[model samples]
Target: MTFYDVTVPISNAMITWPSDPAVSITGTSLISRGDFCNLSELKIGSHCGTHIDAPSHFLENGRTIDQLALENLIGEATVFEFKNKENIDVSDIKQLRFDNVKRVLFKTVNSSYWKFSTFKKDFVYLTKDAAQYLVDKGIRLVGVDYLSVEKFESQLAETHHTLLRNDVIILEGLDLSNVERGRYELIALPLKIKDGDGSPARVVLKST
Candidate 1:
């Protein structure tokens, strides 16, 4: 079996969404300093690094991270690569057959931004129409190669609203640059933060 680690490494220098809390790690205990073991303090946003967004991330009355279905986190997924497209629309999604596809991960120019030293605000993202299209097709999970599924400057928060409102799980900040478009078995497990709106996840894929 060939396993692909699709999660990005999290570090202090890793780019995070603008306005979100910056990631920080500080050593609190060290064997070099006469401590018995090594320990570090970590501070990061719930949406930091590779993470999942629960319905509560956008809907007040929706389920939180812990409430998400485990079946949705592991499934057969299809990877769709989009090129030269600034925004993913419903037409793009319509071109694929979603039957038996529980999860869909999109690889776009956003993967290129990960190579940069700083965050790029122009990552390709989903338009509201595309989000709605997925929901209508009964997609249970959606993953993107950037910090957000919606465009950075989305005026109406339409894309997020459409997916979150329908209980679709959103996985973000994936590092899909090294992978090709194909069917795969996805394993994306988020921290079980009780009643929390979101949580960081460790995602991997095995070629099918």
Candidate 2:
């Protein structure tokens, strides 16, 4: 019963998405301040660090974070690896071996970017066509090793729209650097934010 904690640690030092609010942490109370207990203040974007994007993130009148079922958040998942990919295209998606797989996590080279302070502009991401492929394949949940599943340069964010419109759950900002490409039991539960479009999550994997 070995478990892999695949979530990236959320901290003020962590790289954040451009234009999003920077993570901040400060001590509100400390022993040095003559306080009996230590207290801290925290502020972060809803989608910071490891997170889940709900359908409402892109689709209008779509379901929110609290509305998501636990069954979709926890399940048997396939971890697939891709090397030397600038962006995940339809061809890459077509190569996946599916056997009643409802959840899939892509371990890409983008995970290496986690070590840098600067946000990577060229992170490996899913193309709209590849997103469509997943929708067609009936994937209930899709995860990525980077901050977003869609390309950074995408103005329209068609990839996000395609998946969200199809009711596909998107898990992003995963740190898969330690996890190998194989089958694992996924236990990713997001913060229960009411009517939230997205929220941070604690994602873990159990080896079978």
Candidate 2, residue 93: lDDT = 86
Report lDDT per candidate: 0.92, 0.93
Once model 2 is optimally superposed onto the true structure by TM-score, how far is the C-alpha of residue 34 displaced, in angstroms?
A: 2.2
lDDT of 1 by residue, 1-208 (tens): 8999999888999888888999999889999999999999999999998999999998989999999999999989999999999888888989988878879999998888888988888888898889998988889999999999988877888888999999999999999988999899999999999999999999999998
- Give candidate 2 regions above 4 Å deviation: none
lDDT of 2 by residue, 105-148 (tens): 99999888899989999999999999998998889999999999
TM-score of each model, in listed order:
0.97, 0.97
- The residue ranges of model 1 lying beyond 4 angstroms of the native Cα positions read none
Residue 31 Cα positional deviation in candidate 1, in Å, after optimal superposition: 1.1
Q: Model 1, 79: alpha-carbon shift in Å? A: 0.6
